[model samples]
Target: MRQAVRSQFTAQRAPWALHRRPFSTSYTRSGYADTLRNLRIGSHTRVIFQGFTGKQATANARDSLAWGTKIVGGVTPGRSGEQHLGLPVLPTVRQAVEQLKPDATAIYVAAHQAAAAIEEAIEAEVPLVVAVAEHIPLHDMLRIHSILKTQSKSRLVGPNSPGIISAVGKCRIGFQPLPCFSPGRVAIIAKSGTLSYETVASTTRAGLGQSLCIGIGGDILPGTDFCEALAAVEHDPDTDAIALIGEIGGIAEMEAASWIREYRSRAVSPKPIVGLIAGIHEVPGRVMGHAGAFTALDEPDAKAKITALVNAGVTMVHHPSDIGEVLREKLQGGSSSRQGILSGLGFGSQRRQMSTVSRRHRTSAQRAVPQQKRHLYLSTAQSVGLLIETDRTIRSGSPAATANSQYLVGVGIDRSSRMPCIIAGHPLDVLSEGHLKRFPFDFQRGPVDIPAEQIASHLGLRNQQTAIDSLSRIIKSLVTIFYEKEAFLLISHLMETDKSLTVVSARFGFDDAAFRIAGRHQQLHEMRDAAAEDPSELEAEQSGIVYLKLAGDDATVGTLVNGAGLAMNTVDALARLGGRAANFLDTGGKATSETVKKSFEVILRDERVRVVFVNIFGGLTLGDMIARGIILAFEELSLTVPVVVRIRGTNEREGQQLIARSGLPLFAFDSFDEAAAKAIELSRR
Candidate 1:
């Protein structure tokens, strides 16, 4: 492993000052059946598709099948017994389940229909269901997740994900570019599909092929999360390590960190984990980047996620390009000091490619993306490869992608020596606030300070006054986009030529909230491509609800609390105690019978919800009213699911007495622990 990585990095960089250390070298191979059985994906797994006859599905199916994947059959309603894409198309998942007995089903239905498709797959007991649609209604996801909790037989990969790909297994369930993945020992689990490819490219470049790669999806609450995927990878003997790539929003990274710590304690020889979170991700409500202009990552959410993983013994790197090198270092026990170039610039050793010069400038490989699209919003290295899928075989005859006259590098352009070079979001404006996560570098409230010499050093260029001036000017324009457009991330490939620097390909990620703000950004809002947006998400916003689907298969309890904070707490406490919550419903402090009835109506919509836990602490609301409402709603909805109510504050005793006299199947308690315990017990029963 050391030799492979060392030689690879050496080939990319110039001579380096040598350092020495000793390390152990050990490796183990994996088998088809024993690997990823929890994820229900393996070498022999028979894969099928839901909505297989749809336009997008058909196109992807063609590409996937051609990539040497085992596609057995599919499910397309009203097309039963029909053949599509040279595979049998059944009318329903149930029919396909009965006949084909596929190991996994990749859902390709539209967002509105994604939940139903997943529910049908779970009902049919398909071992693994990978939902490919993005932005399934939050309520739909909650229902599907609730249904999943009823049984231990089914697992869901995504609702808006790239899906799982096992190069060794020859099973490609999602829509990841095929050329990017290679068969090896590392199982990569990434939140961003685009960044996952960058890691794959990096690891593969180091000659470390992947055993499996699972994109848990970019959704805030995906069906399968990092912890689940990490645990699943743990069971795969062939996977010796993990490349965990996450974005800057949510507690997924933090939770995964907790799991890693616990995992370290249990395993005799734990698999090495290397994590990389390099972008300013845009979640629905929060944004990551800039000073007062952005939701600074200084808030514990972003920084803590990265810090947690690092503290949990995850070898965390700052860039995707460094994943392979760090993985090699960790797997080799880091007892061996690195030999080749210092990997400060990441891009150098990852693929050893500099950048594309202007087409008129050179015949070296060059790709031109359509410049007409207004909002590209590309996430990371992965999104930049959108144009790359078409160019599989190009630019072969070169020592490397780098050029003697051309330098390809990405930098944050700090103020050090007039310009400190770092990398940041889609638009270059990320340098100012992106450093909050790495306070040791720049704890200040502005862009970092570094000299042009440092930027030139990383890119292996001589820092001359003219060159420095040119770079400063170019970087300033890029940085201006952040404040102007509220761009949180920037993905661009820039190359410097004899005349000037040119951007061959670039993509930007503007904050979602920026569009909502009035004034200058309103034009950006107008430029929004509704056709490309997730329809279900738009509908949810129109309903004035902040519903986000969370993923957990063992969650069985349905939580209906008075506020969002309480709803979240109930769900968290339930999970901490080994109880899974079906959905998080906030009633907005209403304790009336109508509110209760409405809540019950929504909760019971998911028939798999075996127990409903009502946790309401009265402030302005009366506990007695809540109890009476619960009883009324129970009778009105004809709900058979057991109810566990924990109400406190005003008239708490009255609420308990009311429930006791109601003679309905409801348990009212003053203690939250007891109520929660009862809910968990009923769910299991």
Candidate 2:
């Protein structure tokens, strides 16, 4: 057992870098997946580590090497003539380039210095660079992009990304968890790092593998987006289908969906695309974990993205676990098999044919059929490839063609009576004598405590919080059963809330399952809306801020920053100085003066906002424009919100002069720390 475990672990270890294929003579970029594959770093591509001595760099380097990544050298400023992990460490990227001429460079540097590291590699003319550092200022990225787009011949993958991996080529750049990947024909492109991993795992488990996986960073503006990735995959000869995982925020998913729609309309044989979008349950104006995951009032969210993709004829997966089964069913043009467990429980082979029997024949064979098992009406997505019919006549011809409308039935036993019952909404009298003789089973007969009796009992003994705590586990268990069986169900359960007996029922299909609590006649849509509204209660209350409204009112310090990183820092600075922020508003980069003024308006709208701090570091943006907006907002609102402004970068002097000369109570500062400290102090008064 020990030896077997060791062998498995060893097999799971990353493969060594593949031998370099001859450099492609043509660098002209193509529009399809082939283009991405053409320039992709493979076994032959030598990689250099920037920040090689750093802990993360060293550890990742080891994994890259173990996985057969051909890492040629390392680069660290002022660390020339050193050695790291038996590789030469040059003082600069230029030196490493001059010596090893590596094809790619992976950056592992602090957020403050990440841009400079990328600049160094670009200056050295490296062909490919994967930037793993995150939290760099927005202005720095603009500058880095300028360098990357012009003077450098390098292609930048990410500044805040997990990187890219190609299973078939045996090359991985970035920090992807590699074991989930298997060499197959499907290509996975995702915006979220963890979501991509989960999807890949699902695909691998379902016997469908991947050709490559790209994590396009969760930032609002990563170096690359879904459109470019999709274009690359379109031309890849090896990839048969594309699996896209997107989250809320940004127009990238919409862009990709639009492109797919056009591609499908034009192409003779368009490849199948299956998509799973996260943040379907997200609230507008609230940011999830990703820095780029903020949904504005008018911008597209998960629902819109899903609708667009589905309209474009993409097979939509409601859950990550369903990716593999969906892909196989869609690509193979058939049904998926999900009856292993049921069959093991002695439910004979799914393909068994019963002789032609009338209603009388079924009655006569009632004793032959097991009385301990129940009948279940199951309907599954066409992509899941499961069609198990029990106690029913089989029709000839393709079953999958009518999969959208056909319902399959499976048999199971009632836990208490040990008698057979059907999950379908029907009367027990319609079934054979196998039923344990349970009542009406009609929709009118409400409040049956069969499927959810344990949940109701458990809730009885628990407080609201405790009951809510177990809700996730129960939901997960329920969802898992559906996924495992590749089916959807409309079922009812009993519950007691507010000491009133309520028959709770839900239609479970897709990710957005609807549920209802019966007051009398059971209004489902209202109950579903009520249930859905609870998740984003804070969002439903406020419409402008990116997160829940911070506590503090009319005299508290509020931060108006241009980037997520700066906003987070300002919040932390206020906390450290014994002040609580009233709200956080990030006016994204490249904002016009009008946009900046609009941002100020949002901050000023907060009733609790007292001392507003505006911090702007304009790299691509003009500080003067931002200053103009602030002055305009102050004049228009005729407000008494004492404001502090700190402007840096391009046109900083002019912006400061405009704010300082304004005959208003606006204060200007030279630095962030000073501005934050003064804002916190002023808020107290």
Candidate 3:
């Protein structure tokens, strides 16, 4: 264990300098509504659609306007002055913004065109802009984020998202089904667009309506995160309770939990908060659906997040459907257990009276009265305080249990080390200003109780005031440890439990290797040996015959493709073929345009690759993405190689068209095998 710990610590510490500072300002909840409110959007906050001529954009625009969105105009570049969905097509955001004075803009453009459209919106000073395109390049996203940050008051929903819906105001700003929601008390905030729709349905079904449902977008770097949304929900008077739907990706949930705890501790009467985290089945290192759903190997997982929230006294549910149920119970219960404990301790109702009376005077005056000074009086009061502290510590799963054992020391009026200490279940309540002063060493909250002895030993104090100071130090230390160790454990567990763990693990390996071998090739046997030694070692070896093994019982679609651009197209085509390509293997710069054939035979050796799609685009290497390799193989082996070929690019117009005109045994298609019929045709032959 010591060796393992040392190795882990050394490995982690060594890379500390190289660790990228996690983008902190990506997610914001407070800025969303605040920016919207600042835009001074009234009944006439007209919106313009950028890609309004397209089917998707037109459909969503029609739905949005029908649902009461003030959509005044649209823009479809070359189709200037044309009308889409009865809205004028102005060709530019500047034209539309000037004419309509619209408060917001929603850009429904393709991923490649998204950045330019967003810039147009910004130039037009459209206060609230929603970009509904997915798969945007990281550099483009960074530029948009940088611009949004500078404007601070302008709101941006997503580069790839479903926008926001405010039920109370009857406003539907994005593409979600507005009929699924009804205005009420619950505010639903989630990272997923589809999941938000599901949550809305569940909440409405459970008889709990929504005040506002915001999908903060599922990108790795979102404009709004959990904590910011929590603040808005916390302040919204119409929102009775908040339903936070988070997935396995970032530390946003954990951060939100800490903030919620802090808020409740200071709040006069805080509302109930319920959380539901998704991606419980996701494997560590494997990305499930959204890019933001990726969890670090050492970060908290869905289960651990749920555990932390539950322990923190936040009503937590594992399923989206259960979120509504748990929230209803919390609401029906009326009182937050946290508030109940605080009130029980006389902090809420009797705080003023308790503070006005000097503690020394109260003690001395009570001692002067013979009845009050009785042994029973002192004994009962002391016992109550001890019991409260013990109960609170036990409930929270306090971390003081992991603290240095030698530091365990108890200080109080009684010399007997066994004197009862009052424990509060919620850590925040116990650490609050009033509670800390009254209980001091006796108060234990959060996971792992701080033993009275540990408190006293650390403080090195003999009196009440010193004990209070000691408790403060202990609280700070415990919080730090919980965030560092406990939070990491939670994220790790979530990553490990995900079904996509293997893919993610492989991806992590690729990323750690700095994407050097991602699109390159390697020899099968040599790659296996290197993988056997250390999977990452294969990245450095760079041997030419790429090897991929499909684990478990899953079927694999073997694809031999040339060039990074064509490789991606082939993989996506395979998905459309009702199959998944096992890996991306590129026979690199070493393979001449003529010698590309050896890569084909090497790719076919793996029996796991049942169907091979040889997709080639003529580049520096002359033949098709797949055909050149096949032609070389036929010349060398003097045999038929069964495969489907889709050849395009460079000289493909002449070569592939000649092959098609020749009516050879090779199966060819100009279009990617949309239905996988071509691959099946060759297999049957």
Backbone clashes for every candidate come to 20, 27, 53
lDDT of 3 at 229: 66
To one decimal, what is the Cα RMSD in angstroms of model 1 from the true structure? 27.2
Whole-model lDDT per candidate: 0.58, 0.56, 0.49
TM-score of candidate 1 relative to the true fold: 0.45
Predicted candidate 3 versus true structure: per-residue lDDT over 1-685, tens digit per residue: 2243233223333221232232223234554346644322334567778887888778777777776777888888877767777778887877887887777777888766787788777756777787766556443454455455545446676755677777766666667656567777888887766456556766787788888776777665565566666775676777887877777655666667677777888988777877666644333334444544544322455554555555455775433445566667678875433311212222122222212111111111111112110001112233223223422431111233322211221111110111112222212221123221212221111222334343333333344343443343333332232222111110000011111110010000111111121222122112222223323213312444333333334445566654322343344445434566644444532245344555545555555555667665443344443354566566575544455666544455565765565444666775454324566444434
Q: Which parts of model 1 have CA positions greater than 4 angstroms off?
A: 1-36, 279-299, 335-685
Better of 2 and 3 by lDDT: 2
> TM-score of model 3 relative to the true fold?
0.47
- The sequence of per-residue lDDT tens digits that candidate 2 reaches over residues 138-220 is 43454454343333266677766778887777777887766567888788887655556556766787787888777777654
Q: Per-prediction TM-score, please? A: 0.45, 0.46, 0.47
Give the 10-residue window scoring lowest on summed lDDT in candidate 2. 367-376
Better of 1 and 2 by TM-score: 2
- Top TM-score hit: 3
Sort by lDDT, best first: 1, 2, 3
